[model samples]
Target: MMRVLVTGAGGFVGKHLVSELKNRNYEVIAAASSSREDAAAGKLHGLDITDLAAVKAFIGRTRPDTIFHLAAQSNVMKAWHHPSAAVTVNTVGSLHLLQAIQEVCPGSRMINVGSGDEYGLAGKQGMPLSEETACQPQNPYAVSKFAAGQLVLQMAKKNNLQAIHVRAFNHFGPGQEEGFAVSDFSSQIASIEKGLLSPVIRVGDLSAQRDFTYISDIIAAYVALVETDVPNGVYNVCSSIPRMISTVLEHLVQMSDVDIRIETDVAKLRPSEVPIFVGASGLLEQVTGWKPKTVFLDGLERTLDWWRSRVGL
Candidate 1:
């Protein structure tokens, strides 16, 4: 079995990716940003990508066949609040990983997981953003991720290392925490149903449309990149179909058992948010034969169901 190392293994996407990789028969070494004690307890191996020496020593010791660098301070609002911390973890941390991989295991393939938010202002250029689009990262999170991806690609080219930077768009499903559109809507609806909160669903700019892929489909795209011989540089993982946030919340509310009222929450609104954000997956499909399988409506229903079950409805 091929040995694989996944950073940020305890996170939402990281956890799902680790499970999928293990299911596919790869020897997965789940390295979380924290949880080193878990390693002694037969759990996640702790790894702090921010520490250069630690990263180099770990890479030299394991020499994994592939490294999925998923560690990141992915929360936009949090990154906005703590810009320096975001840069430290996302950019500088990724730099540490790149240097360690280059010095210790130059042959190992690296998949640097990035965000579609990196195409910040470019979303205004056109709909269905592609890999060729110039990135204009608006927020700290986007800036950090873009810098991280750029570093991996540039270092890989110079060092002749096999590396891929994946710009994954909005994705959601069961077990997704709040602070995102779908999960927030689903959680509020569930809470309303369970009578834990009022029958009001507070929301932000629901008119803005975004590309969303189910979590399983997103995981499949990552697996495809690993299994296939994809060329270096960046690739986008997304569903080209654009769904307005209003429609998303509407569908989730429809799935709810209780009567709910939509309330515009000024606190939930983001500043200078793009009206529409979507991405094309033609390149990913053409190369790895990976395309989104779940319909948008179905994914929403599944997410609502998951929330419902969690809230005891």
Candidate 2:
């Protein structure tokens, strides 16, 4: 069995990836920055990726052949509110991990998870974003991710580390936190279903369009990338088709049994939010022969159902 270490193993994506890896008979070791309780049953280790000495020590001890770097401060609005903290976690923490890997597991392979936010305003170009697009990060989150991605590539080239980068777009499903749009919408619906709140669904800017993929598809992309013999570089993990936020909200409303009215609250809107972010993931498809298989409506239904179950609906 291949020894695989997953950082941020307690997170939504990380949990799903770990499950898939375990099913495939991989010797999975999950590392959580906080507590390893979630992965404790699965024999996880607690090690903060930001802690350089701890990271080095852990890598030295376990010596995984493949490391999935997923730990990061991923709140966009929070990043705007706390730029320095975001930089420290997203960039500096990644540097710590890279250095540790170099010292203890020099021959190991790595996958650095980045965000579509790195493209920032470049998504406004109105074309399906390709890997060749020049990044123009508008916010602290994007800037930090872009810088970290650059560092990954630089380290791979300069130090001969087997590293690959993946820029994943908006993904949602079960286990997603409430701050995300899909989870927020589902939670509101769950509440409305249970008579906990009014029929009005509060939301941010509904005009913005996004490429939303199911969490399973995102995990499948990662699995394919790791399993394939593709060369080392960046590839997008996203659905090429983009849908308007208004359309998505309408669909969610249609799925519900209760009557709901769309209400916009300025407080919910993101500052400097990109209007549209559609990515062309041809590079990933070409390399791994993998494409998003989940339909948007089906994915949304599953997400709403998961929230409904969680809320006892």
Model number with the top lDDT = 1
Q: How far is candidate 2 from the true structure (C-alpha RMSD, Å)?
A: 1.9
Off by over 4 Å in 1: 36-42, 265-272
Q: After superposition, how far is residue 40 of candidate 2 from its true place, in Å?
A: 9.7
Error of 2 at 7 (Å): 0.1
CA lDDT scores, all candidates in order: 0.88, 0.86
> For candidate 1, lDDT tens digit of each residue in 1-313?
8999999888788888888887888988888866654322136877888899999999998889999988888999999999999999999998898899889988899999999999998998557899999999999999999999998899889989898999999999987888898898898888888889999877776788889999999999999988999999899999998888898888888877788999899997874367888998999999999999987788888888888888853
Worst 10 residues of 1 by lDDT: 34-43
What digit string (tens of lDDT, one per residue) describes model 2 on residues 247-286? 9889988999998999889897874356778999999999
Question: Could you estimate the TM-score for every candidate?
Answer: 0.94, 0.95
- lDDT of model number 1: 0.88
- Which stretches in model 2 have alpha-carbon errors above 4 Å? 39-41, 265-273
